[model samples]
Target: MSIKPLYRSCDSQGASQRSDELRTYAASLIPTLKARAAETARLGYLPSETIQDLEAGGLFGLTTPRKYGGEPVSTRAFLDIVTELGRGDTSVAWVVTLLNVSTWGAATFFGEEAADEVFGGNQPARVAGVLTPRKAVVKKVDGGFLIEEGLWGFNSGIYHANWDMLSIPIVDADGKVLDYGFAMVPKADVEILNDWNVVAIQGSGSSSVAVKNLFVPDSRVTPLSRSIGGDYPSTHLADESLFRTANMPLAALVLTFPALGNGYAALETFIASLPRRGIQYTGYSKQDEAPVTHLQLGEASAKLDAARALLTSHADALDTWAASGQYMPFDDRAKVRRDVGFAEKLIWEAVDLLASASGGSLAAATNPLTKIWQDARMASLHGFVVPNTNFETYGRILCGKEPGTLFI
Candidate 1:
């Protein structure tokens, strides 16, 4: 299906308008998404209706390159859209966030040929991935590389995508590792394993996938080291600000929005239930009238507010740096990772506070709070968003130390 661009070229005012319009569109789908939340969980993937609604709205291409008829919005705009969707359904937002960001990664890290193959004819190509180069067996071959065999887990959104963006170590003729990079492979070349059952984000359909004896041409493979801090291979780097955004920072930032959405959903659901619920063992008839309940509500609200504030601050920093056509400095980029982990921590706290106040009945599978709590907790555990790890990384950088990892 051909999707039309929402915004062609624009200044700040125009970009802001486009962002507002996209947010409004996403907001309109909340009711439908909310209604389908249970069905999505039961099916362990997004419903076709939900996918169609998103496609018709042009949301899946938010980060697609303009050359391929995509309307690449600013970092802030992308967050706004994803956060709004998360408020409706955590799994749906998570899938959209990963798919869009992976598409952006394809455009930024690869050459013109790769982009043409993925985003050709204005087609909304959904790219899903497990970008960590873990347990991949590869051999350097003539003109390209051959992935002998590998099993990759946590392949989010792969069920609905046409391509998988995988990471592998570049090897020499003697099987010596030279570098680590991403390989763009068609979905048909990989074997999908039906093993996505999990406690949270069930609708994400994050199935495990495998590949064996798959050949990737040189054009579709790019090293991670060169694309770390906006040193990308895409020719559009000079013309497109979105392509110039810091690579790892942008990738890390995309992970936190679904958690942010969970915070909003949990608060709204808990508050709406207050009038109908009571402190089961207490003398207070209505939970909202109790002092303890008030305290919990107030604290959770504050945490949610603080989380949103942190996300906005970092997103603006990314946008500002991209606008200047310069790479975000190492210190600032590390801070983005720190902020993301910290923000997810705050959101998780907020969700936990509300869940605790929800009484014992929340354990029921039918309760929305149950799923929200599980999903938020799961999102917090992601390696990039783990609060203490990111804190240590940022702290080390501040103390004149190396980041200890290549992702930064």
Candidate 2:
């Protein structure tokens, strides 16, 4: 069950060289991932072989601390690797992104003992969790807190994770809500309800998990508000800049890559199929020979390019702030939220255009384009990345009003 690091002496390699090697490794898995896409969907989770391939590639540790033999890759580098994986299969890419993002959050915010428990082992840790608490009850105890009872839904990547980072509301002796914090708990302590039947992103296996009377030590918990404001408890902040980046912006930006990947794959799939297909009821024997086809392809490609530019810019900004040893300001973070939402919207629009231009044949369940379109649309619907909500929040901030959500 132990997973070894991809390269033992990664410190000897330049950042650019290390990034390129990781991206190349992800690209090399596309063929195998594509071959299993159908099986992944049918099973409602990534196949075991796909998980093994990712582990061998050292992808799970992309966001892990170097002390634990992880890369702690830059936000931009992590985004690039996820995009490459997305090109292979959006759901598979999505799961990997969630695992890494959760791992990053855990390592950055929680105490060192918690980090060691999760990532210090020979086997790389995959953490899956949700920020919202549902039906949760907590109580103060001698050394820590007890869950009492709780349920957290949409636990993406839960199927593969050995630990979970759950959000909970701290309470006083009178049961009055004191503060909110995240609880690090072993997966074995919770009950997983495998009810993630959905129309899109089926392979993500985002099932619900429940915990009853669980005891969480104080060392495994971290305050939520301070962490969101860029104050963390991890001692690595002095040496590692990656842990200094703002949390919300990084979370929002990472979700958008799945859509970007779908756009890339959809465009690739449509272009590859164009030469052999004919325009229905038209004079043109080849779809590629038609003027309308050119327009559609042009528009889709342009949208994708714009999305990539926006997402990359947002990531670079986070890196810049992290390097400067400053927390990203509220207004800047608000803009990041807006940018991520818009980027996903553009990607969804692009994929939809490609799907439409491909004709009715793409409606088939067996077609890759069909899944790509569905997954892209699903990515846009996420609450954190929704275009309308994010746009409104940014607009509010611009109008000298509150962003209205703590998530920013």
Candidate 3:
């Protein structure tokens, strides 16, 4: 017996309008990704070939600087790629979101030489990251710091990447550690434990990473003096303003795109069912005939649209600041963060609306919407999108008060 798999595609509406040629290539890979999303969920991680496929699509370098064999796609294009991938598969989308955001850090924090080292000055560069601040502190070694830190949830796009960026804390003999710097270790140095098992986004392979007693040289990690993000790495060759946008919002925004895409995919599923599903109690033959169902679809669709706009608005703000070559002002940065938080809320709401309107079938073990709903909400609790903390922190920043949070 043979069954046709569910082949799908991400919305290319945003990508087609963009000038970047790489997006078209990346967008085309959606069906293959969609085919594997369920298997990824079942296996709790994407198999190696999935990573290889993404690499071939050039997704690993989606945000790499143009100078380093990167397409240096536009912010809109990057968002489009992410949202589309998320639409296809939450786990792949998670990998895309985390990996792209981490590489986005490299463009802004590391210098040209560093960029070249990973991207190889000829092929697209892939960087994996673990930013949860799991560090053992780095002391001054003669040439570099002897970093003995193990980062949890390293999100092994490292399986496809050449460089892995682990967060490290600086410490002196007196035990007063100063500054947060990211250590760049070659994939060869890090050990991956296939430990990513949880309620959602199973294919992310967000396993524990052990870097035991491994040494990272000074040139490997860039010293981000403070969370006060601004232009630093100065890859003068990558003069694209999008590549230079404020590091904070870029990293923060990526964390939410998968949720946005998942919500959209869920909505799409509901829409597909409406044309065929018969109402349970009424003689009505179509789910869409019910006013409540129509309202649910309309409300959920509107929320998704709003979420899209807010996320893009944040990206637009970052684009403006980077183009002007000004540090993204704290106030603007805070607002952009608020937008990210709001976007998260919107996606979660969309999921709830769609799931409720979908009826108990959404609760079925074999139904995909249940997975989408579960994944979207669970991922929203991710540190970057926690609305209460993001709202409070951004609100404080907006009110001219000293903001307290390591995130921005």
Candidate 4:
């Protein structure tokens, strides 16, 4: 059977209009998100109301194909919406970001039949995925491979997802490994393990998923190597730029937007409380009146602005390459990863500085500053945003050496 292509040409004006609508919708959800932030953390999962709002707003379909009732907005629009959501609550933003990117992957990497099953009839599908393979056993069968068993950790948004994309090793009948790829499975096919107890971003519901003797058809599988290099299986839609964008760096870059929002929120939270807060040992009745406070605030703000600039530049570069219908160069792709890590590092540094100047009381659980700090710290520690690995990868590329990591 021939796979149908889902391609629709979008003019510049239509794309811009859709982006504006998405931005407005995302902005409308911020107040609700902020109101529910504490409750989400307390419950270790997002509120049902928040999930409903996100579904109604189409926030989970940011990168999904428009032909499937998805928006397919510009990269800038996607980042803007994610950052705004993050400003309200990092955990919520983290979940939405992962869901949107995974949805995009489902549309781009899977066959048309799989896409129809997931995104047909304007249905809103929340997909959570993790690409790191662990203890996965694949055996060749007649029509597909039987996923004997596998466990994937850090399945963010799994609590709300109906579908899951898991990375697994492809094996031959003789038990010889062939290539690493993804398995698209219904959430009911796997078991969710409640083990995501963390001190930060606790509401993300990043649990582990386990599958046993599940059969994944060939149509639902895509090689990780091909997807990373922009060689997607949905080649019938080759005219669309969204499907052409590099996958690995896109995944890495999206994680930083939420951290940016958290950083901005930290700055806003600290500055807003400055008027009533006072130095513990100093005679200054108002912290805002102190000269040291001014210096710290200014430094943190500048750092945050720098991080924003870097994020914007990298996003623009990705869009440019995609629009031109060309493959992103290895160096440029590496730089995107580097930029994401650097931006995350800057955000964490800014948050730490602001938290330090906010005084010891900022550490109290009742204070929002404490949560913001913890969230930023957790976001910075993500495997994709780890500063040292990205920096080394970019540095190696700059020095005429191959990037040490395969993700780029």
Candidate 5:
């Protein structure tokens, strides 16, 4: 009962366990990720080969357009990859999920020329970005906007990305802000600063970028509002309905999976470790034989199930809407918000329960459970998953209160 069963169960061929074609590819990569995860955290950057393997595994282009030699996979498939990666190294998973989301966002919003340019020569290029358009300088240029600014807290695949998306406000000649555009900048045009030392999520390499007088072409920039409004650059080529869905929902999807993975990781570790780790000074035959331990495991897994349900339900809804080519209304979007909030909350519940059950062994620096506890705590602090804040926002919608944000 010394926590070995949990690891074996994860590797078993149970259909419910995390073992499918995508998960297998992801699981096979765990040895490399686990080997480098600590180094990534200590050095504040991921090795180039780690990035290469991820791309070779087809992780970076999870949602890329199929027309561009990409898979354009489902959102659930994307989450499963994150989950498998998170099981071995939460930091790597954190970085992959965020970078891929930015990549997918770019493919969904940017024009055909832009998609080909980014994902064309590069088979699995990571897209690093920050979506908050703050303190930016933008002016109209020959063919696009001239932007010279830096983005902070940019996470996931920063060192590995060939292109970056910086959130900037496009200003007209009159100095009036025209629109909030996600400006894609080539890696050479921007400089990365290795200033990503943090408390919990240390391995993300969440560095800052510095740029001066970088001219981004019109094709590379996408107006976020228009992308959500159904007027996207991909309208001419692929179906623009991908962008027709709510931006808030898409944003929430990107945020939910990493934490969910961490929660699932904690549950799996606890369950696996339970068989060997007996209670201190208590004569329980084995931790697994104890009635109390069984209760805790069930409770922890139930919380994980709730979180997964929230994510899959929202993904199914969005997929249905995208397939139907229908413009989703506020009501449908509100459901997405509700689902995202519930999933995030459920992650904390699972993490809290599993961490409590893990006891002192889980607190060790080298233990996977330790990282899961820290990562889950940090994930809750993310802006999108701050518990009651989103719940209150969703509650207001149910009570006939108009959403205050433009996303819904």
Candidate 6:
């Protein structure tokens, strides 16, 4: 059976205008988010009101296909929204990023039946995914595969999603491995585990999920190879630029934006406190009056700016390739991984500098800077942001050697 595509193209000018509107809307919510940051942390997840606000504002569907009542905004616009949200609260931003990115992935890779099940309604669907395979048991059936059992951890935003995507290893009747694929399962079929307790980004609700003997139809599964190569299942949306984006690079890049936002928030928090803050017996009435403070602030600002530059540059490059209907080369993808990691490093450095300069006062749990600092540190520890791995991969690629990783 042939499946119809669910996509509509917007002119560049129209898309940009819509993106600006979304950005403006996201910016307007920062104050409210900042006000509820502590409460969100306390709850270990985003407040219902905050989730409703984001949903009503269409932030959750930023990258969804327009046919599904989504804005389907540009990558730059998506990044801007994420960064702005992160500036308010990293936890909220991280959850939103994970939700939106997973939605985008579902739209791009899932078969039409699954896409319709997810995005066919009046409202946009919230989707979350964990790509890392965990205790997955795949058994082939006549029509689909029986996922007897599976457990995926670090499933950010799963608490709020209507659907979840999980990685599975495909096997034949003989139990020989065939390929790695993703399965789109409804939220009702899975069990959420209370395992999200963490010191940073605590409100993200990134917990573990367990599935027992779930049957997924073949139409809803997508092979990792096809997604990585941009050979998506949604032929109806195949012509859409955003859907054509390279999957692995997009995954690597989305994880970096929250860190960027956290960095910006840290800088702002530190600067705002400088007027009344003292240097702790350094003979300075205000920390801002000290020359050393000036140097530290300037250095942190520059580092953050550099990180933003790298992030936006790579974002634009990805968009350019998508819009031009060209595949992003492997080498370029490797460089993007390296650039994202480097950007993360710079963001963390800026946060650390600002936190150190703010002194022991920031040790208070109530201090917003403390949360931002902790969030940045924790976010930088993500696999995608590991400096050594990315740098080594890029170096290997440059040296004409194979990058030992699959998700280039």
Model 3 Cα lDDT, one tens digit per residue, 1-408? 111112122224553344344545555666787777778877777777787877777777667666655555656566767777777788888887777877777666776667667667344656788775554645667667776656557464665556788888765555566777788878778888777778787777777787777777666777666434664766575467666677777788878877877888888777877776877778878888888787887889888888887887676667667777777876777777777888899899989988887777876877878888888988788777888878999778768888887556
lDDT of 5 by residue, 197-306 (tens): 68667888778777777888888888878866756666644553344444667777768877876776677777777667888778885888878888888887787777
User: What does candidate 4's lDDT look like per residue over 1-408, in tens digits?
Assistant: 111111121328878777667666766777788889888987777899998898888788787776666668666667877877887899999999998889888888887888888776444777889989667978889888898889999999999988899998877889897888888998889898888888899999998889999998988888888888878778656767887788888899999988988888898888889888889878999998999998998899888888887887777777888889897998788888988888888899999999888777875888989999999999999999999989998888889888877899
- Which window of ten consecutive residues has the lowest lDDT sum in model 4? 1-10
Please give, for residues 196-308, the per-residue lDDT of candidate 2 as tens digits: 99888889989999999999998898888989998888875457888989999999999987778778888888988888799889899999999999999899988988898
TM-score of 5: 0.88
Q: TM-score for each prediction? A: 0.95, 0.95, 0.89, 0.94, 0.88, 0.96
What TM-score does structure 3 among the candidates reach?
0.89
In model 6, the runs with Cα more than 4 Å from the true position are: 1-11
Runs off by more than 4 Å, candidate 5 = 1-20, 122-124, 239-246, 281-285
lDDT value, residue 174 of candidate 4: 94
Clashing residue pairs found in predicted model 1: none
Instruction: Say what the RMSD of model 1 is.
Output: 4.1
Clashes of each: 0, 0, 0, 0, 9, 1
Query: By summed lDDT, which 10 consecutive residues of candidate 1 come out lowest?
Result: 1-10
Return the clash pairs for model 2, or none: none
Estimate, for each residue in 8-119, the C-alpha lDDT of model 1 and write its tens digit: 2232887778777887898789889999998998889899999999998888888887787777788888888888898899999999999988888888899888888877
lDDT (C-alpha, whole model) for all candidates: 0.86, 0.86, 0.72, 0.83, 0.71, 0.86
Worst 10 residues of 6 by lDDT: 1-10
Clashing pairs in 3: none
